[model samples]
Target: MMDPHDDVELSDLEDDAFIPSTSRAKSLKGKSPNRFLRWLPPRMRAFLENMSRIRLVIITVIVFILLLVFISYWNGRLKDVSIPKQSLALSKELARNLSNTAIPEYVLTYAPLVFLDSEDEFYPSDMAAHVSNAHPTMNFNPVKDAPEGLTLDNLNDLNDLGGDSIYLTSTTLLTNLPNYLHGQKPDKKTLQTENAVSCVIALANKEDGILDAFYIYFYTFNDGPRALGHQVGNHLGDWEHNMIRFKNGEPQAIWYSQHEYGAAFTYDAVNKIGKRPIGFSAKGSHANYAVSGAHDLHELDDEIPAHIVFDQTSQGPLWDPTLSAYYYTYSSTNNKFEPANDKTPVNYLYFEGQWGDQEYLDGVEGQEEFHGFHKWTSGPQGPIFKHLDRKDVCLPRDGGCIIKESL
Candidate 1:
């Protein structure tokens, strides 16, 4: 989760929080008939002389008090739904369940489809985590203990295919987690920020009480800090024993990312393939996943991203485009690369200076020439971007992919 409120972390940001001139309770305390007249400006005080009768003034003060209570009551409930508290038993139970059940479609729906360098489709959260760092601890460095059953994956053979095992993201559970646990809600601030301006300060009379009871108020926009969200959520990926279960209900391979595998004290972002995913477009950005993991997703020569940071961290994705083998090329003839020459990140057929010339790619499905001018002669994505930003986009919630009977 990237920080959605305002890009960048609190430490890096300049303080711009809305601070009231005076506390609401203090300002509204014990108003007397003469008090109003004395405190108000001269012209206003003169006009209020008649209305300052004891009973009228007392009623006005009471009405103001009631409004505050109402605001606090309603706002408190919203906070409960967003950030819920995690139970040790529940976290362990969930980790074990993940090791057995075939993650449901509802769960799959929660994965985040990130914008690749190629501007293509997406991957699940767990898978994204694997690609990002190949470890869950990269996500949970703060936690000191591990839950049961999550210790290892016994379902599949995870000997790297001469490379590394791919961990999948699990926004699916995030999307559907609250359903399994009742009485849990989002953190308090999460809800207040959404409606704070419209709400009155009097509602804060019980602000301390609301904070204590409310669980979901920690507001969540699409982009928020993974650390904050993961902390309260008991992100299972970081546990030492976190295991991968197969579709048929058996623990597969033990899963962890490069960070967890390396065992370092400080987190290394450069080696980390995971981060708050940046999409090519969203509602405020663009409404689409550009293409699948490819080389041309970003503007050419963009060494570092220059967009807003949710927590103001210098960021990168689970994958890097600079290491890929493709370039965003265009010719007067729009030559679309299909079945994406996945062998390498890009293909030379489109760049050999022969694509636009009707020699070979003249009648390609994606290449239509208008007066022999090139429009978009690169990879075109499928009808729908497979992943959304919020879910499986960053980690592999589905766990490892495989099956085996229990010994």
Candidate 2:
């Protein structure tokens, strides 16, 4: 009975002796101080503590991968847009107002017979019809003040209302290659019809009794070439031309518009049907070439290799433009356009705006680019800006026309 208190004191001292030292407890706390980790086994807690040292690096790598994925997604969705620069300035000689003139007999006599590619989806289109299907736009936005009922007859009015950035955007979005956009395919019956208007001729009188007759053809759409299974350089409203220079009513040289450049040939060198020369319109591009074959669109001269893009042409549909076309005489000296007949639509010739939709911007729906190449390019300038009053057989910027004797 006397030793009960002493037993209790001894038990208390023994418990105190078994307790961990303060330094050891501090070491354990440093390893895994988190309350959540304390509930885990010693081995697991140690493992988790060790992993914490490199956690920032692991998080950094994950973030970098996500950034890469983000960049790739936008790259595939967007495209680079190219807006064609304004056309070169007109010649110094200038004048005003419209007039009437006679269509020279030589113009019809030496007019070109165009050969459309059999595989081409688009064909020669009527200017008035195109106007009826489109509305005027500025910088890809609708021009609120533009005329509601725009047509070839009133197209020139746009020049008075800030025409610099104006564009005739299609009323319907160009998708799936619509039938109306394919345009009218000329036939013997349609060609014979007096009201039919599919092509146009602009005559310019040069020095020494030389006459330049430009046969301009229009197409509603221009399909681009496919590269690596992707389409590039597509656009709306194509305008191609073949110019025949005459010396005293005799055909002397012929120029075929191919892409940005053209070639001139002696009158006798080109293939002809009766008194008219034959021009093969390249597939989809509608570029006029003197011969029917694979034309390298990228090659500027014989010295260069044309291993990239090509325009294919063949003897397909034969179209005699002379049978149904509008005729006009462009006077460079006075910068005036004189229509051959009152029925000809001369107002459109004075229009300074683009004839088709402008280039679509990147990230726009249904438009994209691959490897720096755009799926769609800017619409080409109208014939009035194609150096219609050019003095040389080729455009002045072409560095003088190289008249080839053969293709």
Candidate 3:
């Protein structure tokens, strides 16, 4: 006979064998910002405070601000890069027969001069080593009757005219123009043409005999080790420098350092090659002469330091009193030009000499001397270097060179 108890046991075993393995779903546990601290011992809370959300928020804000600043800097630089082509095109389009009257008379008159501070007593021993150095070929004896009322301090009066883009509108002649042709960035390279920007020249509305006007020009170019002049002339102790502006309106000449040049750098070859001996400034040195000898000043040629460019920004070109003393301005108009107007000279020279390269006194040999320049090596000269290397008047800006108020 079959035992009922044995059957029951057999049934229990069968049931156990039939049961299928199933996995139960587990609910997820997300951490709450506050819930996390509850489980920690009170002692750990102090250390945990260091990692609080508030600290994280602070760090995030700081990082965000830094990012914004960096973005602004690059944005301005990139915008500047596009400026040259547009600026040059604008000037070229407006300028008819560029060689003639279109160049403005003041540019020919009172040609800006760039001179070495013959007064500079200090120079690197190595830089002092090689070839004899060059200096300005002109004199910079400030204008005597310069409106008697005009001063570099009144620049802000024009800020209301055009938010920093009105300075280039004047048609009157300028005796001196800045030599910001070669700047650190692509924008600077075209500075003389369009890349260079001039804001409105503001004046306090002259009433009596005194004039209260200011001019500002900003040369937005790159500065420091890796720039063109610095890279090529590093062995020569050259550096990348530039000119910033605060040009003014008021239609007239500002100042003049006598209308003459010297012979310190006016070598024989300079005169023999061309009648109008135009000179160009070194990218970094802003030296008055065109030749970029040897000796890199910043060792910028080998490599641009990784830390050279950090988060920085430019608020357009204007006179920051904090950065103004080192700057200067130039202005011009067409009526000032005389027929034999070597008086109003333009500092720019085309590589091939087509753009007024041959402009001179009709038949005068002195005119043939073309102001003592060689077309192949033409460099613009200006007045900013009047006190070159002077601890006082020189540009406080980092650019080793600042174009003198040239043509």
TM-score, one value per model: 0.16, 0.72, 0.22
Clash tally for model 3? 74
Clashes of each: 110, 0, 74
- Model 2 residue runs over 4 Å out of place are 1-101, 188-196, 300-306
lDDT of 3 at 276: 20
Task: Name model 1 segments beyond 4 Å from true.
Answer: 1-48, 51-58, 78-124, 127-407
Candidate 3 off by > 4 Å: 1-40, 46-50, 80-385, 388-407
Q: Candidate 2, residues 132-248: lDDT per residue as tens digits? A: 888888877888778878988899899877675888888888755666678776563333213446677888888899988988888778887665577777887888899999998
Quick one: ranking by lDDT, best first? 2, 3, 1
lDDT of 1 by residue, 266-341 (tens): 1111121122112222211112222211122113223313331112111112221111111121121233322212
lDDT of 2 at 220: 75
* lDDT winner, 1 or 3: 3
Model 2 residue 291 CA deviation (Å) reads: 0.7
State which candidate has the highest lDDT. 2
